[model samples]
Target: GYIVTHVDRATKYLMAQKIESKTAEAFNKATLSMFMPLAPSKRLTLTLDNGKEFSLFNKIENRLKIDIYFADPYCSWQRGTNENTNGLIRRYFPKKTDFSTITDNELQKVVHKINSRPRKSLDYQTPKEAFSLENMSGALGT
Candidate 1:
């Protein structure tokens, strides 16, 4: 299985799901499933790595109506927040872990831990608190 991650840039809120494949179709379905609960206004821009799984960016943009951008090749710094969160995820899942072995509930538990943990950047506020719809709108100046 492939673990797909979508993070809120402002609050560090993370929405991660486990998918069976890393194909463009899987990424599209995972992304839509992860973001569709929020209003279209809340689902704004998405910055993704230049991975083949994201090759279907046009379809994603059309479905989500969100602007999409890609980081320059070899420039992980452009997506610092996502990279840092991936480090945190590694604490649980690790680099060599077989993602297929983990159940959905186990993945959700990890996500809950991440969201509940306080971040130094947010003045120690948990992402869950900072990610409130109202708070996110204000933080995003929406």
Candidate 2:
């Protein structure tokens, strides 16, 4: 499974999705699905690390019509937001744990817990509160 975060630059609202995949193809599909529900203006750009796992960026960009950028090798600071979130996730699933044992339902629960937790950057607002469908629609003037 992969964790994808979509940040709306204008409002600083973020939508995060946990996607389950068995292969690179499935990963790309899951990534696209996560972005499909958002407003076009909010889906401006995607920045990902140069991991082999993200080699399918072409598919994601083509399907979503969003630009994709890659961070330089060894430049983890460039993707600090995502790197920090990944660290938070590691608290739940450590690096050595076999992800193959995790079920889809269990994965959703993990995603739920992460989203519901308060974020200091968001002034103690949980991501669920800050980036709810209702809030996004309102922010977009929909």
lDDT of 2 at 134: 41
Candidate 1 RMSD to the correct structure: 1.9
Candidate 1: residue 9 Cα off by (Å): 1.1
Total backbone clashes of model 1?
A: 0
**Can you tell me which runs of candidate 2 are displaced by over 4 Å?**
1-23, 133-142
Residue 55, candidate 1: alpha-carbon lDDT: 99
lDDT of 1 by residue, 9-127 (tens): 88899999999999999999998998778777777789999999999999988988888999999999999888988899999998999999999999999999999999998889998
| lDDT per residue as tens, model 2, 11-101 | 3344455556545576676677777777676566788777776888898888877888988999989777666666766788899866667
Query: lDDT of all the models against the reference?
Result: 0.87, 0.67
> If candidate 2 were superposed on the true structure by all CA atoms, what would the RMSD be?
3.9
TM-score of each: 0.94, 0.77
